[model samples]
Target: MVWVRLPVYFYKRNDTFYFSRSIPSDLQHRFNKRKIEVSLRTKSEAKAAKSAAALSDRLERYWDSLRMEMIYSRELGLKVLQDTKPCTTSEYSLSDALALYHRLKGGSKTKLFYDVSNRSIRYLEECLGHDNLTSIEKSDAGRFRDYLFARGMSSSSVKRVFSSVRAIINLAIREQGLVITNVFSGTFIPDDGAKQQRTPIPQDALKRVQMVCQTLDDEPRWLIALISDTGMRLSEACGLLTSDIHVDTVKPYIELIEHPWRRLKTASSSRQLPLVGASLWAAEKIIKEGNSFAFPKYCSEAKCNSNSASAALNKWLKPRVPAGCVIHSFRHSLRDRLRAIECPADIIDAIGGWTTEGVGHKYGDGHTLSVKYRWMEKIAPKVRELRSEETVT
Candidate 1:
């Protein structure tokens, strides 16, 4: 069969052919660039011609649709043309996406996950009237972003809101195989300013705080002491079951696991922590107390109230710690103390439940209690010594 030669927009550079076409001037506003070029990925003229012909036919049909839209826009006002736009509706609404996200991903997730998801969607709906997922335009995203910023939401917080919005919309798109752009995906969120880093508690201040906690020897003090040396997050400590504390074991440690009321932040967060100093003392106290939940005041079978614990703890700690330091500072201080003793980075990451890079890091159960006990022993003696000295003084 003779091949009839049709227009092939093939051009060769560096022995590779590409299909290139210029946008019609009227359609230029709809495109970011003047020309559309796609690599044919072939050096052979026949292959290049075949690919180029197919590409040209596709682009022609697409451009013809655009031309038809413009014709309708001029005849019937832009609003009427927009109202008739095909594929403008989505199978899922923004609220539906949230429901789907929660339904699929909410297992073992705390109330915070649902609360944040709901709040993020509410913020969007408040700004843009709960538009369908597909109907969310780039301009709507921009407007929603501005609305958040106008309400004194920090740039990072604004990004988080957009993140939830994007994830919800994206899940709907993927699960339903919908061909639609997530307008919230790449919207620019301007930085308000440099975020204030949480200052690590000074060694002296930490010792003094531990001393005070020991003197008080109450449930709240136990919470403080538990986190002071263990580097476990406040939520992690607050959510612990009494059984998680293994002081009776040969080498004392806390089995950090996800509870119904609380979830570990990452898979790495689920590891054993060798208790020492204030943390060990606190564990012993907790076991003697004999409650099902370690911090029953904050954690329940229904939910872990880490936020409430944070507020009370931070307030008590405010006058004791330096400006900018909070309960989280103990986690930071633990890292610094470990580093000061020249602890290996991997050991520090293991102790702190911090995520480390590399596939090999994920291979097995991380550092054994005995192995972690050794590294923990090195930095914990100072705080323990302070407890003794303060009691005597």
Candidate 2:
């Protein structure tokens, strides 16, 4: 197929300025015309450019809203005539479809997952002006992608939102048998394979945290201390129950499992991590406290507040740690520590609950909890003495 570069929505006829873009073929039936031509009727280049930009934006918004309503109406079994094509009549709105999707997609997923899905729909509604499934055009999807970037969402974040968009449309197609194409499928998604942005907490800065935790004698700080050693995700650490802590064993570790309050990230996240050093110490102290949770403030049987816990902890931790390092950097630091000691990739994966490479990793019974425990204990404690913390800064 031959492609041609199109300029930003500016055009002119006989010195009269206008904004125009070719409407997509699939969507042209809605307008009964191929091109979006809005006359500004100006002569000056600068004024014409400004007028065209505004008119172009208005026209795109109108088109998107029109398409959304058409899709939504079709999904509800309503026959909406888009040009000559007949669409079945249905009463499903974009919001209604998304709500059904969230309901159908339930089980073991966190509130945050639903939150993201809902947010994506809301963003589409905002930009496209509340239309139904038939209103969704390939052009609308492109605009939504650009809209997300305009809102300062990171590339990875944009991809995640668009993923929800795709899922919503696919679910609508299968369950409702809507004839709409998934415009979200073929959009440009930024590559995000580089290393994460969060920096690891340096060894020196870690001592400061250890000292602060020791002095605070608080459940929150104790949770921080525990995660620093175990390299558990903040949610995993914050959501621990007394039942999850098995200190009686020869190789003590916290049992990471899927709980309603705190869902495991994956099956690998369900493994038992050997708690050595400060984690062992904190686990011992936590059991002595006789509370249901290790950190009562961040965790309850009903829900885990890992995000809130991170926010609170990071607020205090930001100044203590180096720049670019947050409370979660403890997990990053442990991964680096494991790599530095030449720990095997599979073992590291097992320890961190990272998915292993290849189907071959699925065949074996996998490393025993004891084998994981052995590799975990190889790393030493982060704090040799509390005095080290006071010495720095």
Candidate 3:
């Protein structure tokens, strides 16, 4: 691209630039350093340059007015800058940011983030479709907060939406170096202050669900068993392959290896879970199929839908499980069983793939099969004992 600077005069007042009648304000800073001849094609070209210069002059005066307001109030200065800073080439609209975020995640995380963020984006578009990143003020954020409240969205739900927005803005700032601040700071998000709920399935409920799974024709019976037995997340279980299992070893265990393209939701989510009893049996059956996958073809597919698995479970197994219990309740059920067996917190954290307490350490490194298996054995009997107790009651 051939670059040329037009002859222009600029005066700097209070750290702002005002330009003469032949240069764009965008070009004013450059024009001040040197003068260059413009190859004007026609009178029309000259007129266009003159008009741009006039517009720059007007904008500079408007900026001066805002700066004068800033002299009395630092808040006003910040507000003006927040409203006027240009969106960088890479900085995108809320919708665009969400699309990029999903594209980057690419796997099960893409689906999870999309499902959660879509509702929030829809609300944001309705509230501020015309407003760019630079135009989004605290009042606008507060207005949306009120709108969510009116819609009966709980405080936690509103906070989730706010967090989604904050994440998008932070991503833009980090990746694109956008000159926008996180406007979500200091906003009054509602807090219902209810106690946190962590209701795992009771032992009787799990056995009833397992019994229902036995009668179903679905091939994922072992998948459910793996979750209940090993306390692996659905994604982790789904991502497992035949190579990840060591069934023939003296002490059988599953290796929670990380892949280049895929990631566990958290580092702690990557840890070994012992293969024994039903879980080991399931792993062996899957490995014997000659396919590399430990689960069925559909479960391992990149675009695999959990709907069928979920539907089958809900239809047959959910009724057996306690009301409001979900597939994830299996992890909770396993955790509760660990607590009942007096498993140490570190051991429990390792078996269930939970992050360590406090800040520095987030996840447990792989534990030995014997160590993990002991916990599983403890868990299996506890589950059976709970079922027996419930039957007696």
Clashes of each: 0, 20, 0
Residue-by-residue lDDT tens digits, candidate 3, 1-393: 999986553433444333333433443332232322212112343443553354445445644644566566665444334434444431245656666666665455645677776777667644442223544657777988887888877888888888887776677667766666778766897578743565688976666555443345245776786676777877677767778988888767888876532357777777777875456656766677767666654455455445656676546555566676777778888888889988888788888778778754534444666877877776673333433443311
RMSD of 3: 12.7
The residue-level lDDT of candidate 1 at 230 comes to 90
Q: For model 1, which pairs clash?
A: none
RMSD of each: 16.9, 10.4, 12.7
TM-score computed on alpha carbons, candidate 2: 0.74
Evaluate candidate 2 by giving its C-alpha RMSD to the native, one decimal: 10.4
In model 3, what lDDT does residue 267 have?
A: 70
How far in Å is the alpha carbon of 325 misplaced in model 2?
Answer: 0.6
Instruction: Kindly give the stretch of ten consecutive residues in candidate 3 with the minimal lDDT sum.
Output: 33-42
Better of 1 and 3 by TM-score: 1
Please provide, for model 2 over 1-393, each residue's C-alpha lDDT reduced to its tens digit, 9 standing for 90 to 100.
999874677766898766667876666665445765545546777877775655556556866766798789989999876447444422345776787788888555778888888888878765664334564567887888888888988888888898888888789888987766788898996764643688998876776677678777778878888888888999888888888999998888877887778878888888888888777878888999999877888888878888889889889888888899987799888888889889998988888889998999988778888987777777756345453446433
TM-score ranking, high to low: 1, 2, 3
lDDT of 1 by residue, 1-393 (tens): 999966558799999877787877876666556876655656888877775665566567767877897789878877433333243232346766788899988876767789999999878765653334554556787899899998889999999998988888788888867777888878888898857889999887887888888888999999999999998899999999999889887889998998767888998899899999888888989999999999999989888899999999999999888999999999999999999999999999999999999989888777888889999998885555766675511
